[model samples]
Every structure is written in C-alpha cells, then in structure tokens.
Target: MILIGRTPYATCQTAANVKALRTKLFTTDGYEPRVRPIDDQSLPIAITVDLYLLAINDLSEVSETLKTTAFLGLEWEDAFLRWTPASYNKTEYAFWPQVEMVGGSKGIIMDYYEANSGWDIIDSSWSVDTETGDSTINFSIRLRRKPLYFMLSVIFPIIALAILNLCAFLLPNECGERAGYAITVFLAFAVFLTIVSSSLPQNSESVSLVAIFLIIQTTCSTLITILVLALLRLGSFDEKDEKVAVPRVLTFLMRKLKWKSRSKCSKVETEKDGKMHDSQSSLPDASESKVSRIEMPTQLHENRLFKEASTVDEFSWKEVVVFLDVVLFVIFAIILTTSLLGCLVGAQRNAVN
Candidate 1:
C-alpha cells in the first residue's frame, strides 16, 4: 500500500490513517473461481478488501522528528477454522514483489519519511490462539517528520524580526521617536510570536526552543523601549538654571566615561579690584591707588565666590544623556549578537540531528 496524503502536525493524532488492502484464501464448495484480465497480462482476482489504519505518533521528541507507527492485520469471522500462514515454516507472510514497491503523491510535505521510502516494514508476525483457534497477521510501519517546513515558515521569520528590533537603538533620542520606533518593532515581534504560537502544537510537554527565543526577544524589546524612555528623560532638563549641582556618584561616572565638560570661567569683581590696585601702585598714582583700594563689602565678595563655586561644580545634562546612549547601545548590541548566535546554533543542531 502507498501513502497518498498527509495532514499538518497537531497536538493530538489527527492525521488520516494509511490505506491498505488485506487478502485471504477462500474456497468455493464445488467449482473453481473464474478470473478475468483487467490490466496488462495479470488477471484480477476477487475477495481483496480495503482497510484503513490509524497511526499512533510518538511526540516525545517533537522538536526534532515526529515518529509514528501503524499496524495492519487480517481477521476472519469464523473462530473454529482460523486462517494460518501459507507456510508454517516461515515466521510471517511476505508481500508480493509489486506490492512491496511504494510511491508518493504530490503536495505532500517534503520532509516526510514515508514519502521517500513509503512506510518501512519494520516487523510482522502471525498470532494464533490454541484454545479458540483465532489467528491473525500483523505488520507495523514507522514514519518520521522532516521539519523543513516548520523552520522556514515559523523560525526564520521570528529571527528576522528580532534582528530588526535592534534598529531602535539607532534612532536619536532628541528626535523623540526612539520610544515610538522601539514600540513599533516590539509590536511586530509580538504579532509574529502569536503566529508562531498558533502554529505550534498546544499539547507539547515542554516549550520549543523557538518559543523560548521569541520570549527572550519580546523581553529585550520591552527593555529597549524602557531604555529609550530613560534616555529621553535624561536629555530633558531646565536650561535656564545656571547652576545644576551634580551628584558625586554621577561625577565619578562621568570621569570614568571620559566625558568632556565646558570650562566655567567666572570673573570675580574682588580679583579685578585687587589686580587694578596692584597696577595703580606700580604707576605711582596716589589717587588711582586709593580709588582702586576701596574694598568691596566682605559679604558681596563671599557671595560672588559662592556663585562661582556653584557654577563650576555643575555638570551638563546633555552630556550625561549622550554617555547613556553610548552605554545602552553597547548593551543592546551585545544582546542582539548573543540572541542571533544562539538561534543560529540551535538551527544548525536541529538540522544536523
């Protein structure tokens, strides 16, 4: 018998059973049976019956190949005179030379083992009950999946979307579009994840590698969105504030990051007055020296010194945001590379197996 068609994989056994034909020897009471030539030079004999068989699949290693087994046998109505093997010496009946050959039909899944070799005739046996005189002949066949279709349809698309998600980091934070870009890519990943989940078998005992990869990518996309928002916040600050005190930790971080800051040049009135007094004294001008020596109030000098100190102690918010962007991009690149490599290795391993 030949397998003509196959259905998609399901959590349960839903594929149609293989078709087979069963033959038995029977005798007419007083006359020889008549035969007529139907095709070629072979004569057609009557009494052959068609049988449909259900194949039980083992999905324990469904991530790889799916193996299935089917049994076919003959049963007789009369329990008293049961059918026996043609030769008791032989263990089981053998198929005719013509029936042993198998063929495949078009539109069947490419990786189907049955399509290439037909069902492998793994084992056959004859069973007889001594007490009841019941007898039967049984044969079993095994089938394996190719997995090419699933790889192309589901796995590849998901990986592509994951790579595309990394592009969100390339967008500039000042444009206020980084978050939007990341969110859009994240949504695309989600849609593809849904498509993959819908196609996978629902009753699987463990999650498939492809599913795990998608979950990780979704998490990464979410993180990218959050990072973009954080960068946006860092880029925004009150520009009018002349002195923005920076934390010590942030200062240390900036030093470590090698960020450059604009030099604060504050000209104090006290320093200018002192310089003027020194220059006038050298010129030998008594009135000019006295005028320059009129010291400003101590309170004003102290306030000017405090304001200069505050301005010098502040850091630039824009510089901090720029540094954050570089750091986040590095982290994002690392994640993207790791994910891509992991998926490629998995695909290679599956193909090899």
Candidate 2:
C-alpha cells in the first residue's frame, strides 16, 4: 500500500511506538518540559563539537575576511531523551528524535561564512551556565587565508618585476627601446606597490615587512630607470676621445681591472740591473763614475713611473658606465633576494604565532 503525505506515516504502529515513548518521556504525569531537562541539576551537560574543513570559498583582502565551508558534528548524552531498545521493540537500540537549535545559539562566532554553498556547514561550540542551570551549545569555526595565495600572487610577482627591472642592463645599447623598457618596468613596479600598500590598513601603528620589501624594490626600480637614462648618454661616449678624463671615483671603482704594480716593479728592477751592469762594464776603474751611474738610474726610474701612469690611467667614460651596470645589477639582485627572504620568514613566524 502507498502512504500519501504524512497522515498514515504518523499514525502507523511504528509511529505509535515513538508516540508512546514521547509520552513516557515528556508527558505531564512522567516529566515536565518546562523544568531543566536533566535529572542531576548540580552537574552541567557536557557537549563535544568537531569541525571538518571542506573548502575555502573566498578571501577578501580589502575587507580582511575569509569564507570557508566545513562539516560540524555535535554529540552529547541527554538523560531525558534516553530510551531502552527492549522496551520499545526487539532491536539494538531505540533512538530518540532529532534535536532542534534552541536559545538562538548565543555563543557562535562567524566572521566569514558560506550561506548557500551545498557543502557549507556551521561551526559548533557549547557553553553551560552552572549557576543558572542554563546551557547553550553554539557551533563556531574560524579560518584564515592560506599563505599560498599571497605568496604566489603578490610576493612572487613583485620579486619577478624587480628582477626584470635589473635586466635592462642586458638589453642592447643600440636598441632605442632600452630607455622605454626601463621606464615601463618602473611604472609597473609603482603600480604593484600601490596595490600592495593600499591593501594594507592605512594606519601608522603597524608596518608590514612585505610592504617594506616592495617599497625597496620600487626605489631600486626608480633608480634603475634614472640610471638607464643617464647611461644612454654616458655609455655612448666615444672611447677614443682623450679630452674627458674618467672620474677618479670611477678609476678607484675599477681597481680590480687595474694593472698590478708587482709586474711594473719587476720590470723597473730588470731595467735598473741592466743599466748598472752596462755602467760597470764601461767604466770599471772610476769610483766617481759609479756614483754618477747609480744617480742616473734614479732619474730613469722616475721617467719609467711616469710612463706606467700614462698607460695605466687610460680610462674612458664608456668603460666606467658599463662597469657600473654590472656591479649595480649584482648588488640589487642580492638585496632583492635577501630582503625578500627575511621579510617572508618573519611573516611566517608571525603567522605561526
């Protein structure tokens, strides 16, 4: 036979068993629903709540919110709702009916929650007031945005842009787009920095190290754009022109490439020894001539020193500019990685705490 609606289902023999159980548990002659449900008024009801995270729904940087879906399980033993299997029927256990949310669940906390996503579930929490013999079970959960989202989108992209900014040095000098490329990359860095800064709270009480990293990279990019423009002129200076002497600072900067004085000293010693031997061969009997010969090599040494300086001091503006490019590129690259690692590690520790 087919049962229509809930009429016959509510009046069936099995339903009668449930109805009889309810009467025996909650009727006026057996127990009052108005009073506290537990027989032991002194003891508080203990409830256990568990949450299973299902999915991350959305994360809002501006609002600083994280939405998630999860499953909630609540378990407690209600003395009034208890029953015996043999009394109801021949079965393993006689289960009571479902429990509804009561007291509006006063203690639940929900900063970000999924409303209608099918897998969404509310968090669970329970509070018992022993003095008033009042208890409330409130389901609650809190979730944070995963670090992967920030690392992949904001942090890594800024680092990549900073690295790209350094690559302007690698571009051909003859290309007209070199200056334009550098300026364009700087502007992109500025825009990204703006986004990062704006996402943070506009207060001075706290500063983010990640934001500091971006600011440093942005400053580096700014200097790179300006330096590249300057190098466009400086790098193209004619190397053959002897009128423009390289700055002494640039000369000092390129000391690594300077000719070693050790080799020059060895050459000067060889020349002095050759001259002494020649003077001794020519005038072996005269002591006065020997003194004169020794003095003559002193003047020769001064002339040799002047000759070495003229050859060694041949510095062009073009060389200085290129040397600056290689050096700054390496330095800024180190700054980029070191600052990034330090800030990220600090952020990780803060998150863990």
Candidate 3:
C-alpha cells in the first residue's frame, strides 16, 4: 500500500469479518503477475486483467444502480494502474476499491479489507455481502497509440517540401528567374525545417525525413544556381560577330542539326549588288571584259550560304523547343534517379533489418 492519491473507500465489509479478513490476507497471500509472451509481429501487445469494483448493497430485496466507491487499490503493476484510465458512466475514475490481492487456487483474488472510515449505512441500505464471495471486475487492456506526434512531425514536412520543389519546372527561363526562384524555395524549406525541429525532441537517431528533404532541396538549389550562372554567360549568340564556343557535348550534337540561315546585312548587300549588275549589263556600250569583272563580285556575294548566314537574327521555334525539351528531360532524369536511389536504399536496409 502506497497511496496513489487521496480518495476514501466506501466498503461493504462488516466490522468483524473485515478485521479477520485483513489478518488472513496480508499475512498469507502471495501471487505474482507476468506478461503473455507473443511472437507475432503484427499483433499489438495484449493484456488481460481482472478488476474488482467494491460496492455496498442493503439486505432489502430492491437493488439500486451501480454507484462509484471512491477508494481504489491497484494490486498488480503500479505503472499500469497509474497510466490506464478506469471510466464509468459519464465520468472517468481510478481503480481505488477497498480490496487487496490474495493468492487463490488458480491465481490472485480480491479480498475484503477493513471497514472504510465513513458513515454507517441504514439497516434497509445494503452493504455489499463480502462474506460469501469476492466481488470483482475484469477487463482486457492494450495501447491505442504509439507516440504518433513524433512520427508525423518528421513525415509531413518532407512531403510538403518535395512538392514545393516541383514549382521550379513551371518558372520561365528568361528574366533571370531560376536562380532567385531556387534561393526562395530553398529558404522556405529551411524555415519549415526550423519549425519541424522545434517540435521534435533531440535524440540519437538516423537523419529524420524533414532533414533529408531540406538537404535535398539545398542541393537542388545549388545546382540550379550553377545552371543559371552558366546560362547567363551563354548569352545571346546571335548578337556578337565573334564565334560562340558551344559546349563540347552540344557542339558534337549540334553539328548534325545546324542549318543555313540568311542574315540582314548579307541580304541587303546581295540586293544592292544584284541591282548594280543588272544596271552594268544593261549599259549600251558595255565591254565583255568589264561585264565579267562586275558579274564576279556580285555572284560571289549572292551565294546561298553567304546570304543565309547574314539574314537570320533569331532561332527558329522548333530549335528553341527542342533545346528546352532536352534540358528539361535531363533535369527530370536527375530527380528521378535520386528518388529511386533513396527508395532502393530504404528497401535494402529494411530487408537487412
């Protein structure tokens, strides 16, 4: 008897019987409790317990409804009694009946203890007849939850941050948007991680899901930052007279895709030279020698390759689309590969465990 809390018992034991019962109970009784070992992984922990709710009833034939007796005693594991709730009617209560554990033929039995320190009941009022048999309540116990908050706090943020990262694909490439967008999303993930860490307890464990998400997001942001800088340096190739050095990989691929295009300067020069040749050939006293000289210069500049190179100021829509499609596919490949690797690692570890 350790007193869990201050709640008095309303016992039904008679004076003489209660005194004798206590002497017999505390001196003779010895029973021990143990767990029911279960090997199945799917099954949750199961507990079977016999509980007694002590009550008093008058000798009169008419019986009343069940009433709460304040005194509660827990004879088994003290830890279980303190944690489990014993709810009845509309209100919840603790098991504080006026009883004690005594060894029986099969297992433990509840015995009537001393008279509760309370007012005596009327003659018509029933005091529960404890002299004949033990009055007990039985129940089966199990846990409902296993620290769900700890698990959810780790899982939800990771999923949320991963979805947020997908926003990068929708952002337009021009206007120097990709770098800023990556930085903003990265910072947002950092803020979410800060909130997640505040909720979780500090403990020794593998990296949590939220931490993994933040790290991945940061890595993506760094990669995007590098790509944005590279693209900025690539610039508008059409604007400069100097030959743009394409990437070795792209140059190899582009050699097969390159096509002729006419620039404005070459087209203007060609039209002017054509008019001069026509005027020269139309001259009434035109010498054949002078005609050949005039025709050679115009013919050289009028060729398809020379004129096409000078006139094209912009890339065709089809080429632009193809370039973008390839770049986006590469990005998608990286994300898919990383996700598959994570899944593979998780699965392998699970199998090993």
Candidate 4:
C-alpha cells in the first residue's frame, strides 16, 4: 500500500523521539521558542513537522573561513554547519527552527522546492539512520552589522589618535612652539572624541573603547596643560634666580670665536697707529720716547679692558631669549614624555584585554 502524502511510516515515527533526544543533547532544558513552517510544493511528499526548536553552535572560529553555502558541503559532517545569507527580512529579530529527520535508510539528497504559500525551501539536505534513530538541525539569525560597527567606530580611531601623540617628541622647544602644538593636538583628539560619543549608544557599556580613549586623552591634555603652566612660571621668575643663559659649552665656544675676531681688529688698528707715530717721530725728538712709551701702554690697556667689558656684559635681550627658550624646551619635554607613556600604557592595556 503506497500512501501518497505524509504517510505514517513506522521508521519515521521516531522523528519526535529524535527531536527530543537531540534537543536535550544540545541545550539545557526549559527553553521556549517560536515555530515557523517551511514547506515545498514541488515535492510529491509532504513533511509534517512533529517537533521543532532552535539550535545554536559556537561558530566564531569557523565563521571567517566559511564564505558560502558551497563550503558547507565540504564540512557537512561536522557539528557546525555553514550558512550563506542571501537576504534577511525581519524587523524584529528571531531564531531559526531546528529540524529532525528519521526513517530513510538511504543517504538523504539536497532538495529545493516551492510551496503553495509562494515561499520556497531554497536548499536543504537530510539524513536518517536506524542506529542514530534521529538527528537535529539547529539555526539562528543575528544582527551582524552592529558588532562590526563597534569594532570600527570605537577601536580603530582611538588607536590612531594615540599614535598622533608620539609626534610631539620630534618638535624642538626654542621656537616658543610647545604651547600651540600641544593645544592643537589636544583639540584634534577632542574632536575625534566628540564624533565617537555621537556614534555610541546611550545604553552601551561604560567599558567601551571610546570611554577608555576619552579618559586617556583628557588626562593627557590636562597633564600637558600643567606642564605648560609650570614652564611659564619658571620663565617668569627673576633672571638672577633662573640661571638664564645658554649652556656653558656653547658660551665658551662663542666667546673664543669673538675673541679671535676682536684680537685681529685690535692688532690692525694698533699697527696703523704705531706706523703714524713712527713716521711723525722720524726727526728723533727728545720727548717722543717718553710720550710713546707711557701713552701707548696706557691706551692699549684701556682699549683691551673696554673690549673685555663689552664681551662680558649680559644684555637683557640675550637673557630674555635664553630664558624663554629654556622654558619652552622644558615644557615640550614634559608634555612629550607624559603623552608617550600614556599612549604606551593604553596600548598595552588594550592588548592584554
């Protein structure tokens, strides 16, 4: 007797038992789920589902490699099955139904069919065994785009901003440039933070990457501000207390170079004066020796003392410039060091987590 549609086969009667056994095996008890019917009109045989439930397997390790439905065929026998999404249509999220098969001794074939409701089973496969008695297929639908955005908006931008902080070390402080540079970099990070905050969900977790970066950058900015303030205070102090001058080595070299120039000039002037006096005294006057001997030494000593005084006297402009440059360098060095260390710690913490 050949029964046409949904004939109750004795072997197939075990579908309910198989569904229960597989459900218990895969999930803990007491799970409630929605049910949706999948039907095919092309097949002469009709599938009457006695039991259906949702099944979820961890696919994080394999999801990257499984590109299409074709890949599922290669690893079909494994505990996990690959799925390629053609389209997903549901305003509200839902889970997929777990299906169980039984009764067929021969291997199951992949099937595609259209049903009366205009819906089609695009692709499916089934296998049954008397020893196994039943088998279950579990499925789930997810909103994937949200998690991807989390990685992009929060994680990558924070890292890039942190990298920018490293550039401060390359700048020199003598240009009175540290204050402006630090402020600009701080504002840039602040703008990035504003964009990040706008993108985040209000109810999102506090431990998010944006939150971490905001805290880090804010701290860095504050520290740099403090350094700038400190340097400015040092710069404002009395020159006597500040020890305001270029380094001793540079001063020494500068003095030596100037000394050589001045010595050469003095020698030329003295030679011209001596030549004039000699030519004037060519008649061998009696008092000439006395005047020449006494006045020449006195004038030479006076001129030398004048030159030395000029060389040694500290000008206000020179002190002011040196003081400002020292202050700026100190400020820049502090800011650069603090920012770099903060970035490093932030990176290491992120990596560890």
Candidate 5:
C-alpha cells in the first residue's frame, strides 16, 4: 500500500517471484529433488559439468599421487521450477539455496600433508546463473610444488656420493686411511638409500630406475671396499719375498695399458786393467768396482712410484697396485656416469609413456 504523503517504490515483484517458486517446488504437488527432471520415463538426465583448475596443492612421487584445487561447476534443468518472466515481472529469475551441500568434496579431495600446514579450506562460494530455465552453479576454489626439487635433492646428491665412492681408490694404500675412507663412504650411501625408501610407498608395483641405479652403485661400493683391502695387502708384501709374486695376467695388463715414464739413463761401463767394471747405478762407474747386474722389467716407474732402499728397476708389486687402482677407478667412473644418465633418461621416458 502507498502512503498518502509519500511516493511508493516497487519492491513486491522479486519477493512475489521467490514466494511462487518455493511454493510450487517445495509443496506436495511439486517434484522431489531425487526425481529426474525429464518428462519421459526412459530418458536420461542431461547435466553439464565443468571443472576449472585453479591450482595444484602438492605432488608425491613416492605415492604417485597429485593434489589439486579447482572449481566444480554443475548445470542442469529443473522442469518443475520453470516460470514465465511476465508472471514474476522480471527479465530473469534465480533462487539461492539456503543450506550448503556440506562436506560434498570430502572423499573427492586429495589432502596435502605438512607438519604445520592445515588441510582445512580457507573459503569457498557458489552463485546461481540462469537463462534457459536451467540452473547453473558458478563455483570457485583456492590452491602451491617443484618437479626439479627431487632431481636436485635426491638424484644430484646420489651422483656426487657415487663420484666420491670412486675417488676412495685414489688414496694411497700405505697411508692406512684408505680402508676407513671407503667404509665411511659406503655407510653414507646405505643411509641415503634408507632415507629415500622410507619416503616412498611400500606397495609400489613398479621399480624405479633411480632405485636400481642406487642398488648398482651400492654393490660397486661394496666391491671397491674389498678390492681396496686386497690392494693394500698386496702393497704391504715384502719386496724380497719370492713366495709372493704378481700374477701373470696382471703383468700382461700392465704392459698393455702402461702409461710409461721412459728411463733416460744410458748404459755405461769402464774397463780397468782389462777387467770390465759394471755400472751399479744409472751414472757411469768412476771407480773400477765390480757389482751385481740388475734385470729390468719392460715397465718403468717414475719418482711418483714407491720409495724403497733397493734400486727398483723392475715392475714391483706397488706399481701393479697403482696400475690396478687407476684401471678400476676409470672403469667404475664410466659405469657410474653411464648408469646415472641412463637412469634419468629411462625415468623420463617412463613418465612420458
């Protein structure tokens, strides 16, 4: 009703429309929510669903799971709720639902785990839009992971540790620290593997290339430890002992892969009173003193070789140990490098597939 002294503004139109929709839809004569909106009994309900991904919350390589946040928009027709615009005196008509669809996304959502981070949603909202007697919900949601983090923290560090394991062979065996050094490196690798396995899901059916790579590396480290001890023992043997001798195959390998330091001293001798004075040292014999001759091996070693009282003209056990150390280092380094690269490449291929 309009007051006699005041002008009336029309506000009853929207209120009337809402009241009509509620009564028509909610009354006993109206349709139920569970009932299909279609007129035909055999026909299927056509509902339009759209998901707009807003963010990615987390990623777990171990579990092979990804967590994300998005807008789950749903649109459908409610034939019973339709009304004529002229009857409501409005261009468009919409009714907002009073109570929310509480806990709708509980089982559907993947929760990210962090010690201090909460799994609770900050906020969420929805709005209704209609044009062709259809109800559309415009939903909105809010979302944070780096793919390279694993490569840097896990893969790169493993490569570095493998390289360090190979370097243990470079330490001199006589120093008495090589054994301890190799053992420590192996222990560190074992610890790293343990930590990595703990984070991964135990029920995983597929084996990771990275995991295989680490196992191979661990085996190599163990073998290296044994070899180091053997080499140390070989190095400590008495030079004069004829009982312990270098193997013939090792001698052959040394000649084949010899990084030679050629001897510069030439053979010289002096004759005194028709008696030949053999040169004991590399220098020419000034005094006519007779000395025992020394037989030299094919391989010559430099001052970097082991220091001994006797003139070590021939290839000694120490030289063999040094040669083997270099050979093993080269072999393992190549193996580790190749395997690491292959592991990463294979893993990437699997991911793509």
Candidate 6:
C-alpha cells in the first residue's frame, strides 16, 4: 500500500486520507493454461481507499504554527505472518512521489497562510517485532501558520483603543469628559477582549501572545479611568467653601509649577501694617489717633473684602488638575507606545522564527 495525500482538520485534531493505493498478489495453483495472449494475462490490481484519521494538534504556537501529525499503521501477529522490506529488494516500503496536502483548501483562512513547512512525510518507518510479529508504519505531517488576520482584526484594534484611552487625558478635566472618554475606551477594550476570547480555543494550555497584549491594554485602560476619577476628586472643591484646604503635597507641586497664591499672604501683611500704623498713631495726639483708628478700621474692612475677592480668583485647584492631566498623559503615552512597539517587534520575531 502507498500513502499518497491527506487533508487535516485543525480544530478537530483529525484528517481525511486523500489517497491510498493497496496492492494484492495472487498465485496460480498447479494447473496451467494451454496458451494465453499477453493482452489476456491477468495484471496486478490496485485499489484506492479514503478513511478518516486521528491526528495530534499542537497549538503551543497558535499565532505561528498549527502543527498536526497523522499516523498510518497495520497490526500483525508473529504466529500468523511477518512483514519486512520487499523480499526481492533491500529497501523498505517506499512512499509515493509526494503526499499532497489537499486539505489546505478546507482549512480556515483568517488572514494566515499555510507556512513553508507544508506537508512533509517527516517520520516514515516500519517497525517490526520478531517475538510478536507486531509491525507498524508511521508518518507525520507538520503545518505551520502565518498569522495576519489576527493582528489586524484583534491586536490592532486593542492597541488603538489603548491609545485612545491615553488620549482621554488631553481633554480638559473641567469639561467633565475625561472620565467619560476613559470609561468608553475601557468598554471598547472589554468588547475586543471578549471577541478574542470567544474566538480562541478554550482549553489552551498557555495564553496567546495576542491575548496577553489585550490584557495589558485593558489594564492600562482601567488605570487611565481610575486616574481620571482621581483627578476629578482632587479638583472637587466648592467655590463657596472658604475652609477647603488643599493638601500640602499638592500645594508643593503647585509651587513647583509656579502656581503661587500670594493674595492671602499679601492681605495678611497689609493688615499687620495697618495695625502697626494705628498703634504708632496712638502714641501721638489722642484726637488725631482716635480719628485715624476709626478711619483705619474702615480701610482694613475694605481691604478684607478685596482680599476675599482676590483669594477666590487665585486659590482654585484648576492648575493642579491641569498639571496632573499633563503629567499623567505623558506617562501613559510613554507606557502605551513602548508596549505597542514591543508587541510588534515580538510578533515579527516569532514569525521569523
């Protein structure tokens, strides 16, 4: 018998035998015919058979390779019969000229191509046991995958959503859209992740690289959303609340950013100077001092009103929010860019290998 071709079913770990030919030999008893023309002589017979075969599927490199192995064998008993290489020749059973992979046409086409490995009769051998007369022929076919559809459909979209999440920081926090944008991008990432998860095999032993990348993207999106919320909280202060104190750390950061609130300090200094002037005037004429003190109280009261107005204008947390937004945006952009570049480079390297 000769093994000629096969079609592999990747998802099912099975294949359909494309072509096989069996040979049969017959012997004539003692009787002989009187005469026979060459055209009338019996010839060797050949028959073709197709059968379903179980195969081993290796998905370790799902993104790179879809390796499958099919086996063909016959069992023999020592007491009954023993098989060997051709009795007249030294060589073992020979393979057909080629084992065509006719099944490639039936395989899934998700932007990946059948890699160069193709159909190879990698391990062809006939093993025989003298004691038991057990015999077997085994051959394997290896298929490699080249992934393009997955990158385009799954990976690229996830990366784009991640980038969009990073860009949410560019929206001004006062507009109240930064958090919304981050949440929307996070939801988009979740949708992509669900799509990818549903497409991949459920019982894979290891995570796909694309899945890992999507997970990282989702994490970044979630963190960006949290950051937006935190910024909103940091900037949440009632304009009517006079006693809302800014944190010392935030105050320090504002100073570093050159956002100084000098109106309150200046107001305090002016009040101190007015007190000193009134005290000094009291050391002089009583009537003039009393008149000066009365006028001084009115001036101090007017100064307090002016100081309150200036304080309201100068003490807002808007600068802190803007600085936080800008800083976080830069950090997130760097992280996202590095992650995307690394993933691309890694994928290319895996494909090459």
Top candidate, metric lDDT? 2
- What clash count does candidate 5 reach? 0
Q: Which stretches of candidate 3 lie over 4 Å from their true place?
A: 1-170, 200-205, 236-243, 255-293, 301-325, 340-353
Report the CA-based lDDT of candidate 6 relative to the real structure: 0.60
Residue ranges of candidate 6 with Cα displaced over 4 Å = 1-148, 203-205, 241-243, 257-290, 293-315
Ranking by TM-score: 6, 1, 5, 2, 3, 4
Q: In order, how many clashes per candidate?
A: 0, 6, 23, 1, 0, 0
* lDDT for 76 (candidate 1): 28
- Give each model's whole-structure lDDT: 0.58, 0.68, 0.48, 0.47, 0.65, 0.60
TM-score, candidate 5, is: 0.48
Local accuracy of candidate 1 as per-residue lDDT tens digits, 1-353:
22322222222221121111112333322222253323233633344354544564555564776655654444423222223433232223322221211222332333544434323233333322223221222222434345577668776787787767777666676786778888898898888888888876665576767788889889988898888887777666635655355667777888887776653323345456656855555575666766544543554577578767745564667766666777777887788778778877976886555
TM-score of each: 0.50, 0.47, 0.39, 0.29, 0.48, 0.51
For candidate 6, write residues 1-353 as lDDT tens digits.
22334222112211221121112211222222343312334753233444435565665555886565555454322221122333323332333332333223323333563435423222223322223222222333333443566557776777777767878878887776777888989998898889889887665587767777888888988888898898877776635564365666776676687865655577678778867976776587755767876777787788679767655545456666777788788888888888778877987886555
Per-residue lDDT of model 3, residues 7-50, tens digit only: 32424234454444434334444212353233453666544455
Q: Report how far off residue 256 is in candidate 4 (Å).
A: 33
What is the Cα-based lDDT of residue 298 in candidate 6? 84
How well is each residue in 49-106 modelled by candidate 4, as lDDT tens digits? 3322233322345565422221111111222211222222111111234333433443
The alpha-carbon RMSD values of the candidates against the true structure, listed in the order shown, are 13.9, 14.9, 20.9, 18.7, 14.3, 13.3
Predicted structure 2, TM vs. truth? 0.47
Worst 10-residue lDDT window for candidate 4 reads 70-79
